[model samples]
Target: MDSLSYLNKYFLRYKKKLALGVLFILISNIAQVFIPIFLREGIDGIQQEVQYDKLFEYGLLIFVAAIIAGVFRFLIRQTIIVVSREIEYDLRQDFWAHIQKLSHRYFQNNSTGNIMAHATNDISAVRMYVGPAVMYSIDTVSKFIIIIAIMITISPLLTFYTLIPLPFLSYFVYQLSKKIHKKFTLIQESFSDLTTRAQENFAGIRVIKSYVREDGEIKNFTEQSEDYLNKTMDKVKIQALFQPILYTIAGLSVIIVVWAGGGMVIENLLTLGDISAFVIFLGMLIWPMIAFGWILNIIQQASASMKRLIKILHEELEIQDSKATRTIINSIKGRIEFKNVSFRYKNDLPDILDNISFSIEPGETIAIIGKTGSGKTTLLNLIPRLFDATNGDVLIDGYKIKEIPLKILRQNVGLVPQETFLFSDTLKNNILYGTKNGNDELVNHVAKISQLDKDVEGFPKGYETMLGERGITLSGGQKQRSCLARALAIDPKILILDDSFSSVDTNTEEEILKQLKEYMKDRTSIIVSHRISTVKDADKILVLHNGRIQEQGNHDELVSLGGIYADLHFKQLLEEELKELS
Candidate 1:
């Protein structure tokens, strides 16, 4: 659907509040329209030598009308304007919720800064249009209808002359609104670029400083900011012409009324009170004319912004919960199998894994060892369905992995990636993040199993230490160990560690593995590592070579076979002996 149609759906949800606001506006205009009538009466009454008490009564009625108009005007804003804010809130919330449901591939292709711009600037623009623009447009049209009828009744010729410039004004507004919409779309695009550039600079500030390239980054950012400014100024120039042109049209109408109505009154064709009341009615049209131009500007900007938001909101979910998929709410046994699985990052790209078949029993521990690009990590990712295999099937407990509900499947599997990420929160909070209701006992248990407890004892605040962005406050090994503790705290039935011990010393790695052995009873564990010591004791070891499994067996059996696993083991043994000699 188009942007306007999409927004209308949200507007209709709060139509009751909007209708009440319009009613209040109509009542206020009616009250205001009576004031001019009373003024004409007071003047004619004085000219006819009416009683002082009667004139006082007309004056009193005028005051009452003004009060009623003011009160209803307040009510109009209270209802309609408040509803706009409520709709803005709902739109923002829904936008964020949709963003969260998007897959990892979506995030990989879109920048964080660009998404943030939609949430902030684009959403705010749409809100302004829905709120004030809508309110003022209704106010302007309703008041114009009532006041024009009254003016024509006072003097038809004068009213006809006053409306001559309105058609020209409408033509000008139509032409300019189209230009404004085009320029506003460009401006929003520029703003997104500026946001993306700024976010990149901030995130890579350390790299800039380390390489002494701060000046270069600043220059690039300045150029981006200037482009945004130029785009804004272009839109501003178009908007600046709008109000002045509207005022000129309105000014011409007033001039016509004064010139023609003055002659009528002098010739006794119209009374002094009648001419005075006609001008008062003409004055009411000024705001409506100006609002005509202003609302158009609002509409153009909102259209551009809503177009951008709709692009995201209407995006198809590439990975979704299938209707035929089973809902497994209970804990799943971690029996995993890969049948002739093959995967590529993109269809045109070369396969990262090809014709791979493997299986692990429910309580078995398996390890994957490979060169840097041999698909070790890709094979592990299939278990959690991070990216589905391009061909063939992945099964868990005799059922297709897709058959299990995503929430239940993920909850039972804990994965600690090579590149660890921790929130800028207390250490205790980070560990307990996966296990939302975890107590101290569970935290400590996982900490010891991951060998993270020893490091916490040296911290100033112990488990309460506040980490910096991405856990910058911790050392590399500390980050990895803490992440392990977090994953283990969830008590997952299937734990996958992808090079999780790369930063830790062999002694520490051995200690963590020993503790993990006890934790692995009745649970399946998949370890992806380069060090022979890390995976030498696994029940099965699979050596991957060039997108294919080269060998798979117990470590001793592979060593006896003198294959890729044997070669890796011998090379690692030489490196360790050299390290000891040094």
Candidate 2:
């Protein structure tokens, strides 16, 4: 659907207010038209040496008309402008809510700054057109129609002369509208680029400082700013010509009316009072004409902004439940299976997991050990359906995950990724991020199991301590533990820890694992780690190499087999011995 159709629905939601606003505009314009009639009577009375009381009455009538017009104008703004603000609020909130539901892949393709521009600049532009532009456009048209009808009754020939130049103005404005829309669209695109550059620089400021590339980044940013300025100037150039052309045509119309009407007055074809009122009415028409040009500019800019917003809103949701697969399971058994699953992020990319298969029964602890690029983390992500396999099926409790509702499947699974993310909120809030109804007892229990309780004890406010952006105030191990506590707070049936313990010391790791074993007794646990010690005691160990499972067994069995798992264990043992000798 077009922007107009979408906006029409929003407008209809406030139809009563809009109708009232239009009525007030009509009243205001009618009152304004009466002012010219009062001027005509007052001039004719003064010419005839009329009594002072007669002139006073004419003056009073004009004053009353002006006051009524002003009051109605105020009402028009209160109704229409307020409704536009309400619609803008609804649109922006819905935009943000829709953005939150989009998949991780969507974010991977679109930058944060680009999306932010849509919410801020684009929304603001749309509001400008919807509110003031719409209000004034209606006001202008109503005023123009009223004044033109009055002038025609006074003298059709004079009115025709005044209106002859209007068709030219209309043609010029139509041409300018198209140009303005194109230029404005380009300007918005350049603005997006500028915003993206600034956002990247701010987010990567630490990297810039570490690499001593601050000057280079600033230079690059300046170049982007220059490009934005140039595009803005281009748009300004088009707009600069708009008003002058409109005024020129309006001026020609006035000149024609004055010259032709003056001759009529001299030849006794028209009275001086009639010509006086006609000029006043013609003068009133100029504002509406000029306002029409301004309205067109606003509309063109809004159209460009709306088009961008609609593009993102219309994007296909790549990761949503199908119509027939909206089951909300009451409980999850935590049994997981990868049935010959092969996967890649994109069709052209190499398969991260090739024809891989594995199964973990409920209440089993499975450790996955693999090299850096062996799809260890990717495999864990599939369990929660963060990304679906390109081929084959991943099932939980003998049911394909795609058939299960996303909320039900994800709610039962807890994932602690290697790259932990913590919001800039209190430690307590971060720990209970994904859970509902987080109580003190649950928070403390999960923190203790994740070895975060001891750290919280030393904090200034315990669990209430506020964190900096991405939890920058906390150490790496503390952040990881905090995230682990968060996942545990949800009381998930399936827990997948993807190198979650890398930052903690071995003693702390052992302490956490000791507590976790009891937690895993009734839940399914999958640990992906590079450290052999981290997963040595798991019920089953699967060693992956180059996107395929190289071996699978208990620690002692894998050691006896003398494969990749055995080789990794022996190497880690040698490293520990060397460290001891040192």
Candidate 3:
């Protein structure tokens, strides 16, 4: 109940609709309450005299009341139930928008399946509370109040006797509701685990098949399914008691009405019609009692789900534009500078980039060559502010990266990472993904420069070919080239190629670089690669070992220095000579 307070704004947002629904509830109950009264009149009149016209009149009145109640009942659902769906849509949209703004670290910590469960199952549960639970709660309460008030007016003592079981019913439901809330929370958690298992298995199906672990995965998934089933059964067992307990309590009240009302009728203190009306009124009370128990179940489930949703909604954004950001500066010339930059993912971990200081001039092409774990990717990430430097400053065009607006900073830089990723979309759309209104000419130009034009031409649909999930339909080199074309489509001021050519042959790499040289003449370029051949002709070459720069020079100067770069170059030359001899 406390957790559900977050939805107060939504309630207020649709208060007019809710108010109309309440009005309809009141009108429907008002009409329904009179049916018992009309029954009493018809029964008494029939005993007094055999008058068919009078009897027909009472029947017609009862029929009219029922029709009115039914119509307004329909209106109640149209307003309240419809608003629930509207709120669900708004809530889902807000959840997705917030998720997009969350930091990359948030995704690393949370599983995709868990988030999906929250978006689907949890939101639906909350919608039940907003819709059916609310509607029925008002329906039950108003019906009870109107019926009980009328019953008391007819005979106070009989009404008192009939209501004796109500206090006990209330106490029983309160205790059961606590258990329901606890069980429901466990059920939601188990459901999340079950969803996560299914999602992971599907995403890694290829890996599982390659490793011949299908039987193992099936056994594991079966265990999770059984666990979810058991948790649900436990909740169902608790809920199953509700109907019988409510009906038993309602039955007791019915018995009391008959026993006490019959005695009064024998004494001539009450008529046959009064007893008949008392019985009809008591029957009306049964639905309210049953509805009370059902509403409690819905509330408990909704509360549990709302708590989970609130946990995600309350997560703070790790990186966002602040007051210090310079919003007026919408573009950059791409003179990137790292002033004693140092970074680590966490405080306790050793630095991946330790006191690295370098500056790239507006048009310079700088290449970083390093061993596998040499922090090359981490350095490129800082340029886009994907992760900020833990110490010192990263600047663009002499402005601190933090001072530049994030959207503007990122738009000015293009990055093609080592691991290529593509959406399940057309090749043309994938190539043009980075630009707002990229024409086919731009797409074709970038595709040609990245050497992806030849591959696209070979496909049956050319640029219209739809890729499989994560571009599984394309080869490794094709995916990398597609990613390169996407980066080029942006026409960014600073271009970063982080081992992006690892899959392509040396000839294709050479051709792409030859075209890139002209395209990058006025834009700053950063290349990170392991190949000596790749960095040999750069304006400047940087050699990194561990987390620090070991050498910095052009190919000839580094070879003359006889350092780490010279060793790598000699090894590559020897490998090439050996390949030619073979």
Candidate 4:
């Protein structure tokens, strides 16, 4: 119930349409109530004396009333149901926008399938409440009030007797509704799990095929499907009782009306027409009674879904521009400095990077070399503020990194991470992804610089070649080079390449590096790689060991030092000689 309060703003936004819908409900119900009156008059007039013209008048009046009611009923749906769809659109947009603003940590904690379930099933459930549940609630209330008032006008005693069973119906619905809400929450959770299983299976289909675990995966999915079916059956069993019990209660009221009103007619206290109208009014009340139960079912499901949505909407954004951010500092010259910075993903875990202090001048190319699990990538991530440092400060262009707006800071820095990801798009569009005004000229330039132009030219459609999902059509080295071209297309002032050349052969790697040497002459460049050949010619080299810099110098000086860098260099040289002999 509290979670449903989140929709108050949307209600206010569409209040005018809701008000018009209410007005239409009143008008429709008023017209519908008059049908019984005309029937009563016609029945009494026929008993008194047979007059064809009078009977025709009554029939015509009844027909007009029915037509009026039907028209307003259509108008009611036009206003109320239409507003529901509009609100659903707005809510979905808000959900998508909020998800985009959430930090990387949120994605790590949640699954893609769970989020997709929220976007599809959960949102549609809430829409049922916003549209159908709300519309029917008003319709049932207004119809009940109108029908009951007319019934009381016909005979106060009969109306009072028929309504005696209604209080019991209310109590029965209340108890079942509570159970329904709980069961619905469980069902929604199970649905999320089921959706996640299917999503993971699809995304990892290649892995399953590689391991030949199709039978095992199929068995697991079958188990999940059975679990979901059982939960749904449990909920359906509860709902199955709703209509039968509702009809039984409504039938009880009708019996009381017939028995009580028939006795009055026999005693000359009421006419035959009055008894007929009483029966008709009771029949109308049955629909409202059934609608009440259905509305409760929808409301319970919507409440459960809204609770799930609200939890995600309330997730705190870990990273955003703060009040201290400098709005005027729109660009940076790419002088990066790390002052005793240490970072850990969580406070309970050991630091991935510890006491890392380094500085890069505006136009120098600095290379970082370390074994796997060292903090080479983490150190570079701090420059672009991917993950904030746990202690100390990182400054860019002599300004604290946090002080710069994320948009401006990231726009000036181009990074090609170790894991290359490309969209299923045309080769030209993939290269031009982040640049707003990028033209063919810019795409061609970066492609040539990154040695991707040759591969694009070899394709049947050249730059227009459409890639498969995650660029699956390209070879490993082609994907890496394509990612490099994307980064270069942004025309960034600072370039960070995290092992971007691991897949390319030595000859191609040398060619790309030669091209980069001229392209990166004035831009600050940071390279993280395991290849000694890649970092040996940089202006300065930093060798990391166990989350700290072990050595810092040029290639010649590091070789003279006879330390970790020298040992790695010597090993790589021996491997190259062995490869040549082989």
Candidate 5:
């Protein structure tokens, strides 16, 4: 949607408060207009020998009008400013929801630090523009128009003389606002870079310390901080220029009004009251002129921020889901097939997987064995549609995976990625991550199979132990087992253990694999492992080399064939024996 249209929706949501704010500005300015008239009337009343009682009544009326306007001013703020905060709340929420709906590729390309800045700082800037900035801009413009018309009506000659410096004020404000906007954009970008640098250091602090690079990191951070400082100074210097310039112009207007109107009053061409009203009107115009510059600054900053947000919000979804998908079968038989699939992360790069074909029957165990950088994880990722293949289709139960609803497709497919992440919560909560309501039965079943039950019980808090972040964290092996338990708790039709046991002890691995064997009997299981012993018993095994299938068969059949898979199995077997002897 267009940015203005998007902003207008927010306007409509809080229109009542905005209307009330404008009413206050109108009432306040109008009440101010009467002050000069009251002073003029009092002067004329005294000059014409008016009665004391009559003059007292006129003064009382003036005082009552001021009080009434003050009440309106109070109402405006009470109603409007609070609504501004409410609009802020809504905008923040919608912005977050939009980000969540974006595909995983978006997060891959954008850093968390950059996204965080947009959600917090940038959005707050937009909110300010919407609320106070919006109200005051309209208020200033309306008041300027009202005051100028009133001054002209009182005496065109006096008005014309006073407004000679107005055009210069506009020109100065325009140029200054443009410069301020450019500097502000630079400042925001610098902040993003600084945040990214700080976050990276924090995440890899152990490596930094181990490598004795603390001084280097601090130096890099200092450079980033310095750059941010320079950008902020630039913004402040430019934006500050206008405030003093605007105030000077206001002072000039006052000087001109006094000089010209003093001559008219002395010449008897204007009343003392008329000249008084003119000076008051000029005084009133001062605030709006200053606000005009401030409003221009706000608009420029908000426009720059909105453009940055648009770039992300309008980004294309790399993987599209089907709209005409129906419910999946209650119990999937777990047959998977890949037909002549070719895939690449970018169009400019060479294909990562080229024309690969594979099929696995129901309730069968298949091991995908490959070395690092051999497209092992890439192939597995395609099953759950982390990315769409460039060519051909992947099917489960004779239905194209892309045609099925993502919710249904993912419900049946369980994946344990290499990096195991757990939220900052209790161990039991982590184990039951997506399985709402804390399913103890399912949690305990998976924990036992993953051999995490023993590990969890060893903790003082047992299953209820708080883990993650800097809390009472577990070892790498324990964490992996907890992740495995999480995946298993989902009770998926197709279970994929992707290097899930790499960090565990040999005895623990043996026990987990043995338990997984029984679970795999009536389900489709795909295991990716570097250890030969982990995959030697699979019904079928495939060896992948540089994005292509090099060998495929049962472990014994492949060993007899003496290809890549056979060589790897024999090498691992010899290595194990050597270690035992030592």
Candidate 6:
């Protein structure tokens, strides 16, 4: 019950429609109860042979009342169920949006499949409880109470015998609820594993096929499926055992009513019409009882699912908007500065970047060069405030980066990451995706700069050609070029390219740098690369070693010093020359 408090708020939101559904059930049940009285009157009237037209009139009135009750029943479902669907829609959107707000750490801790299960299966289970299960449970209980009261008014002795098994059924339902909730939770978790496996396999299908592990994949799926199947069987077995017990007690009550009530009729203690009405009341009670068991199943499932969803909503947001601090400046001049900053993804582990301090003037190109894992990309990521530093501050002009609104700051900063990701859409759409208002001319200009114009020309449909997932249709170099075009389309004030030209050859890379220089004057640009050729002509070169700036100079100054920067430049030159000789 404590686990279900969050769901109760949504229930309250749709309480109006629920009240209407209950009202309709009340009207329907009243009409149904009247039929027993009408039947008794017609029976007694026919036997007495007094007023034949009166019986026909009474019967006609009964039929019309029943018809009207049926009409209200349809109206109840239409109104209340639609309202429930609205709740479902709202819940799913919030759930998805919350998932997006959660930290990257959450993704590292939880499986993709588990998160997906909460969105799809868990939400669906809650929907069933919200709409159908809630309406039916209310309808079932209300009808039983009203009908039973009417029966008691007619004959308390008959009601007593019929209700003897109800206490046992109540206890049975309570016990079943505890067990059902536990089992359903297990079943849902098993399904989460299964869904995760499917998602993982689909996303990594290339690896599986290349390795020829089709049989291995099948066996893994089968094991997950078996666990899910067993959980379901456990649920069914409990249902199979309990449903009969509920009905058997209900059946005994009916048999008891006939044996006891029929003898009363013979002894002149009850009449035939009274006995008939009592039997109708008993019959009315059975559907509600049977439905009670079904409702329990829904309630337990919904409870489990609702709690699972709330777990996500309850997570503390990692990247929260600073409420205590307001922006000191409205706009920035794009002068980027990094103070003595130190950062590590892990608390105990050594720093990925340590005591790094550098500044780029308003309109200059500064290239970073390092070996792999030397914090070249990490340094670029810090400027956009993707992950906040453990110490020190990054300032744009005079304003701290954190003080700027994320939206405004990111709009001014464009990053082309090491791994290129593209949508499965036309090449034109992917190229012009940086800014919403990007024009054809802007896209083509960037495409020429990245040397992607030739790749687009080779395609049968030119720029309109559709690429596969992650731009699988394009070669690695072409994909990077397309990604470069995307960032360039934004026309950002500060551009950060983190080893983006890794896949492109020297000639194409040279052409890209040449065109980029013309288009991106007066705006700050940071290039991160290992090849000294890429950053040699820059205003300044930053050489990072184990997350610290070991050298900073122009190409000539760094070469003269003969430190880490000079050594790396010579090593790269040697490698290129050796490759040519070989």
Scored by lDDT, the top model is: 3
Q: How well is each residue in 10-82 modelled by candidate 5, as lDDT tens digits?
A: 7798787788788787887677667767877787777778799978977897897778768876776676667
| lDDT score at residue 522, model 5, on the 0-100 scale | 76
Q: Give candidate 4 regions above 4 Å deviation.
A: 167-199, 232-242, 470-472
Report the lDDT tens digits of candidate 1 across residue range 193-291: 787778788888888899999889889889988988998898899989988987788788778878998899889887878877777777777767656
Clash pairs detected, candidate 2: none
Compose the digit string of candidate 6's lDDT tens values, residues 1-582. 456668777778878877777788778778777877777777767767778698888789779777877887787787678877988998998888898878656887797767877888888888888888877787787888888888878788888888787666656766776577678778978887898789889989999999999999999999999999999999888867777877787778778888999998889887777887777777777767666766777777788888888878998876545763345555566899899999887798789999999999978999999879999877887887767788998888767777787667877887899999888998889888768887779878889888999878778888888887554388899989999898888778898999999999998999999988987798899999888889998999999989989889999999999998888889889999999999
Query: What is the C-alpha local distance difference test score of candidate 5?
Result: 0.81
- TM-score, candidate 6, is 0.89
Q: What does the lDDT read for residue 460 in candidate 2?
A: 73
Alpha-carbon lDDT, every model: 0.88, 0.87, 0.89, 0.89, 0.81, 0.83
- Write the candidate numbers in order of decreasing TM-score: 4, 3, 1, 2, 5, 6
Question: RMSD of model 5, in Å?
Answer: 2.9
Task: Estimate TM-scores for all models.
Answer: 0.91, 0.91, 0.92, 0.92, 0.90, 0.89
Model 6: how far is 113 from its true place, Å? 2.3
For lDDT, candidate 2 versus 4, the one ahead is 4
Off by over 4 Å in 1: 50-55, 167-198, 228-243, 300-304, 470-472
lDDT of 3 by residue, 1-582 (tens): 999889989999999999999999999999988999999999989989979899999999999999999999899999999999998888889888988888876887787767888989899999999999999999998998899899988999998998788767766776787787788878878877888778788888899999999999989989988988998899899989977887788788878888999999999888888989998888877767656876888898899999999989989987789888988998899898889988898899999998888888998899999999989999898998778899989989999898999998888899998899898999999998989999999989999999999988889888989986654399999999999999999999999999999999999999999999999999999999999888888998988888788888888999999989889889999999999999
Q: Given candidate 5, what's the lDDT at residue 534?
A: 84
TM-score of 1: 0.91
Candidate 3, position 338, lDDT: 88
Error of 6 at 513 (Å): 1.6
lDDT of candidate 2 over 457-560, digit per residue (tens): 89878998889755438999999999999899999999999999999999999999999999878899999999999999899999999999989999999999
Off by over 4 Å in 3: 1-3, 167-199, 228-242, 470-472
Cα RMSD of all models vs. native, in order, equals: 2.8, 2.8, 2.6, 2.6, 2.9, 3.2
Clashing pairs in 1: none
